[model samples]
Target: MLFGAGAGMLAGLACGGGSGDDARPAVLAHIGHDVAAPAFATLHERAGALVAALEPLCAGPDATTLAAAQAAWSEERDAWSRVLPFGFGPLPPELNALDFWPVRVDTVETAVAGAPAAADAGYLGGLGVSAKGMPALEYLLWGEDPGAALTAFQSEDGARRCGYARALAVDIEARTDALATAWASEYADALATAGTGSAAYPSLKAGVDEVINKSIDACLTMVKGKLDNPLGNLSGAAEDPSLMESRFSGRTRADLQANLAGVWAVYHGADLDAPAAGISVLVAALDPALDERVRAQYARTVEVLVAVPEPLTEALVADRTAVQLARDELDTFRRLLKLDVASTLGVTLALSDNDGD
Candidate 1:
């Protein structure tokens, strides 16, 4: 769902804390709650603007570099747009790099051989759907015109087995991991190509990954809490009446608005309570294999990239003056990058992980 630039930028502003404070944690500081379906629509418009801006840069950074950038960008942006009806989660950076951006780059570099590109996109799409939860439920639960929309989403009758409402969560949770593995398999050769260390893409990748991990945790922690369903299923509520009220009884348009205020406070460097459901669920599903992959991805970005992203590697070993100059230049580039969408469309993207379940 996309709106005009104002709607999209407003939605972007409604996201995690913006700036002015260096002491604040980027993810925890913002993670806004004021986001709604409209805001969610706004978000996509803004991201689309970003994708449009990145098109030229995506092309100039060499085939392999562009491939990686496009992969991360596509994964993040597609997942965001695809999951609209359900709601939104912050687009963490790492997942964007590993799964989405490469595919995007490949699409530009080699669209004729789309088989390869599709695989990469499919894989990240799978991974992303696996991770989406709250957005799914938010739409499933309250994304309609109070009575009519609510009944339709919740209705379990003919013509509405699963509506556009929790499909994303189902896709991501059940089918994504395998699909992502396949995406990786499809683009093995292209993905294997070494990228020039100069593209600051790796830093962005690291940031995206961190944010995804945190969001995963946040989703897990929701269990038994307001949004909790032990199995983390979007359909869990539709199946069990008690579960729905227990989790969302107190929730409303106003509550989400209030939560956004809390998110703003975080940006301002205020202490905020961690989401009980999100984080807990994520940790529960963590495995040694996934952990290893995450580490390797982190290492690859930090070790190979020129930028100084946190958590991917150690302290910067570059010349201090040169690094400062580079940082300033990058900042300038970032500022030049304004988000604007060609057109805005309203579509209900169901965010669910019930693909298998």
Candidate 2:
């Protein structure tokens, strides 16, 4: 039961071309080469820039240097967010190692205190995921207060704190570099050649299903984990700002937008009007109206999300209505992909680890 009764009826009427085997290879190639490879490369490049920016801040803690480092981190975060849809390849194993969120303040603080004066990769490798990655770095770079953050870097333990931050940046740089290399050198080909001798995907449907399932997972992450938890929609309790992601840096909204952008990239290809190849190609070929509906729904979701107030943490308490509106829109978008589009493709929906209320 991948679809509901209504969705099954829609599938029966819309899914005229069977499993869309003929259009899969082109879509896979477009996503692997054009969308994912470039995104990971940009992430790697931004990771390097983050390291470069942090070096100056670690050397001399100043307002200008700190701002530069924060900007660099934001760029890297955006790049990482845009690749959220491509959860296969080298990404799955390294996921937590790269961006574990709801960052534990105590864990990071302990690591900063215990770390060597000059923390390096070996030292960072011994630390837990809570003490490293983008979220941890966000805590280090932009703590509760901007002035206090700078003063802490200029205090007695400044060297150690800055050293730990540098080490985290290096760890991120290494991981992103490896991810980009793996995708460009090997995984891209494996995905593009799916069902035609690629061992990763035994059939064309497997590859397409992987893409669709990951997209659905991304949506679920936004609706349930990002929005619902923060809004306290999962529990019977009131809104909990602490549950919000990217709260330290106040970039939760940007992160959600980037997640949707990644999904859109998978659906519409690199460009919207003149797509090279995307899931839209297969869907439009089978049912043009469904494709149009998906496109419109995606646009509506983005629009509502943009209307929500910034610093999603505060919005969860003060502007809950706007936030809930955005969440509802995202759930609608999720249903379109999970039900209509998946059934139309004859794709068997797979359960992701993130799948839940």
Candidate 3:
């Protein structure tokens, strides 16, 4: 799971034997242009929508408005989760600013109390990770009782919370825009031109390998961090939903679902926007049976996740068996990913820049 240069089975996979080498450029292009670019673009758009939705809620705090804002946050958060697994090039520095979880509730409380100006991205960005990202917003918008939060927003201190929330949303919007612009203008080329003496990635395979590893890491994170860590999948351990991502918003289940969706996108080399010639095509060409197995397992894993109840933190205690079942399913998915996918692609996994993440 550690993010270092990938070796192991992928290094042993035979390479340079067929048209596989020739397919690298097309695959890289698909990843940079078709896959990554659209995710960022959509993220940027969704972040903007989130800000717009927040504006209404801030101006008039109520249950209906709060619900609308929460829905918007989920939309933006889903877009962001899809893009997070592609953590390379121009992404790492911005990730924490986007969604640092297990958010410091105290820091967010302080920031809300201070109610700094909302127009300043610099000021917003300088705030602690917990105070400026999605998790912080989750706390403000949906804490334990969203009704109470709504009431508070309507109270005298409502302005402070609303103002702070606006500032955070503005910061998110700006960061997403910058990311989209960077990928479109520069980072995409860095990935597409990898291996042509590119400093970031010595070879196209290295670029592809980095993404593949990130996808694998993303899956592991879902299993260990999102699911098992909170569910206490280990024997005789009590579950702890408090450790779950987006617990304040009851979004833990949705986050893993989004994570799985991201992994699928990375494997197939496509996203919500368009389909691209991806590693799946190459793998299918190389080994149809392995490709089919991976596809089936990936689909099944997502299904298992979808079948798990929402507010996964609660599901962990109420129906721990379901959580364990999902964990087992993810374990299978991870093996096929870390072992079969890497071997078929003839690319080794490496440490992501956010390695050990």
What does each candidate score in C-alpha RMSD? 24.7, 4.4, 5.5
What lDDT is obtained when candidate 2 is compared to the true structure?
Answer: 0.86
Question: Model 3 Cα displacement at 61 (Å)?
Answer: 1.4
What tens-digit string does per-residue lDDT give for candidate 1 at 74-153? 33334333222221222233233322211122232122222222233353253333223333223323222344333442
Weakest ten-residue segment in model 2 by summed lDDT: 12-21
- Residue 196, model 2, lDDT: 83
- RMSD versus native structure for model 3: 5.5
Please write out the lDDT profile of model 2 over residues 1-357, one tens digit for every residue: 345554444354343323434667888889889888998999999999999999899999999999999999999999999998888888988889888888999999999998989999888888888788999999899897657678888898998999899899999999999999999998888889887888898777778888898999889888998888878787778998777878878889999999999999999997766853788887886678999999899989999999988888888888999999999999999989998989888888987664552
Question: By descending TM-score, how would the candidates be arranged?
Answer: 2, 3, 1
Using TM-score as the yardstick, the better of models 2 and 3 is: 2
* TM-score for each of the candidates: 0.20, 0.93, 0.88
lDDT of 3 by residue, 308-345 (tens): 88878778889888888888898788878778878777
Clashing pairs in 2: none
Tell me, by lDDT, which candidate is best.
2
Candidate 1, overall lDDT?
Answer: 0.28
- After superposition, which runs of candidate 3 have C-alpha atoms over 4 Å from their true positions? 1-21, 117-119, 122-126, 234-236, 271-276, 351-357
lDDT of each prediction vs. the true structure?
0.28, 0.86, 0.77
State the lDDT at 214 in candidate 1: 31
